[model samples]
Target: MIKIFEKRKIWYGISLAIMLIGLGFAIAFKGLNFGIDFKGGTILTFNMGEQVNQDKVQEVEKVISDFTKKYSARETNNTEIELIIQTGAIETEQVKELKTKVKEEFNLGDDYLVQEENISGSIGSELTRKAFIASILSCIAIAIYIAVRFEFEFGVAAIVALIHDLLITLSVYAILRIRINSPFIAAVMTILGYSMNDTIVIFDRIRENKKKLGKVETGELINSSISQTMRRSIYTSLSTLLTIMMMVILVPGIRELTVPLIIGIITGTYSSIFIASPIWATLRDKKDKKNPKAQYGKKKKTSEA
Candidate 1:
């Protein structure tokens, strides 16, 4: 028995430390690196007319760097040798000159400048708001589902674990200055669901054990439940992480999604095993303290024979 509940403070402390580090970074730094999808900017697409190699990417980045400090360049998935550049709003003549410079630099024809469009900061603001709302709503829905399926305490603990996973992921993003875009929001939503599923598995095990072992101490029951499910959780997270890592290595275009998946899986598994169960045990312990006879695992007979 790992005595997980007995060492609750250690787990909680570790999580608190991670969260604080991320918070400290966020405070010391200006904020997260919001990509054009969230911060809003102009999208410029160019067709090199040939496959864009790393050298080509570096050249495009150099050209873009001359225009705006806040910009991102990536090779698009289009079959037509596309490169997309996003940057803060620049003047009309500047856009024209940029096109000319790109054309001259690469010997590209006039039509090499495939598309140009501006995204308003207001629209980006709207997206940020919607993303926040969606996350809150999803958390609420998950809590409701877990509460109905198990107990309210379990639901709350699971939410805490999910939030912990979210904070850890965002911390990594902020620390690394990763771009937060539409794909990031989608990835976050996926992380929340994935994390919640791991938590539910452990909670399910705890609930089952509570019934089968009617007189076990709360901490012992929690430890046993976690121990029983820990292997399964580890295996599941590892398999998912391996798949995502392979995707991240093999598919460059989907790094935005795969990177977060990797972070979420590790944190999710940790929280499910170390955080959520301890929290539930603590909550149950508190409830037991409030009413001595209503201790966890103590079955009450309806009538004495």
Candidate 2:
């Protein structure tokens, strides 16, 4: 055993060191560039009434930019050019006129239309609220599930580890100034699901070893559990991360989601092995000390009925 628990301070320090950098940027630079989905925006899907090609996409982007420059300079900063979906944080009137100008510039007839989807600020606020609620519920479910299956100590440690993974991922985004959006929230939830599974496997091993090697120190059991599961955790994270990393690098339009996915997977694996399992072992040891009868071989006595 390499004294993994004894050196927990190092592991925890490394995590916080990275996180503090991100926190500094967040406070100083106004945090992430919240995307249209979270900040409310207008989406114009141009039905070109023809086979949409790269040339057409570029033409549409140019026309929209040129027209917006004349009328709404402030709105251009919040704009984006997707294939047919142009999203921006412009006002309601600007959205309608921008669509009309693009149609006129392209000489498109009635058959060719520009569909407008304007998400109001209130709606965006509502979406933000729902996303937070969903995240909270997911965390609660994870804690409850782990407590039922393992011990309450394991549950608390698992949730703490989960928060660690999420904060680290957010830090990466904040440092890079990546926009946080509705999809980002969904990604976080997905990462938590994967993270919970990984943590559970290590916790399961620790529980089994406690049963089999009844007299070992809790730290020694945790070290054994981590070593046993380290390979599986690394391989699973590596494979998933490679695929997403390639997609983020090579894919044209999905950088929004892929970036977060990559960070989340790496953090999830790191937390499972370094943060979650160690915390659980520490808590389990304290629990055992407080009530020695809780050890595997000791059975609580029931009053004679």
In terms of lDDT, the best-performing candidate is 1
Query: What are the models' TM-scores?
Result: 0.91, 0.79
lDDT of each: 0.81, 0.75
- TM-score, cand. 2 vs. native: 0.79
Worst 10 residues of 1 by lDDT: 78-87
Clashing pairs in model 2, backbone N/Cα/C closer than 3 A: none
Model 1, residue 84: distance off in Å is 6.8
| Tens-digit per-residue lDDT, 1-305, candidate 2 | 55677788899999999899989989988766666676666555555656655566667767767545322111111133332222443555766687678668877777544344666667778988998888889899999999999879989999999989888998888888877767788788889999999999999998888788777766788888889889999999899988888887676456667778888888998899899977877777677779887664233456987
lDDT of 1 by residue, 212-303 (tens): 89877787888899889888889988888888999987888788888888888888888888999888877877887899886776445577
